[model samples]
Target: MSLLVTLAASTEELAPLLMPPLAFAGIAAAIFIALGFVVFSFRDVANRQGQGAGKSSDTHGSGH
Candidate 1:
């Protein structure tokens, strides 16, 4: 009974420090995901630039 009481007391004191580590991990994960999306989008933009498809829309007005 005494051990349970002590353990519960420690847990209450440690909760604030514990939650911030989890929060930091979550924030780091979000930053990683954002960077991955930026790299992927830039890669695709570069691929589009190489395909010569960017001018098709500009010439569409002449067809009308």
Candidate 2:
């Protein structure tokens, strides 16, 4: 019981020092993943075609 109490106290004392960096890393990862999704969505749009004859929109009228 004494060891558990001491461990809890030590963890409490270190939590403040440890939490901010861990939180920032999680937020940064979320932002990076979101940005990647946005970029991929845009790329998909840019390379997309309308109603199909099997050609990309970007090559519609630029003389092949």
Best by TM-score: 1
The window of 10 residues in a row where model 2 has the poorest summed lDDT is 45-54
The regions of model 1 sitting more than 4 angstroms off are: 1-19, 45-64
Candidate 1, residues 1-64, lDDT tens digits: the string is: 9999897778454344656677989999999999999887777776777566657756677553
Compared to the true structure, candidate 2 yields what TM-score? 0.41
Q: Candidate 2, residues 1-64: lDDT per residue as tens digits?
A: 9999887778444344645787989989999999999887787554454435446555677564
How displaced is residue 42 in candidate 2, in Å? 1.1
Q: How many angstroms is residue 44 displaced in model 2 relative to the true structure, after the best TM-score fit?
A: 2.5
lDDT value for candidate 2?
A: 0.72
Error of 2 at 14 (Å): 14
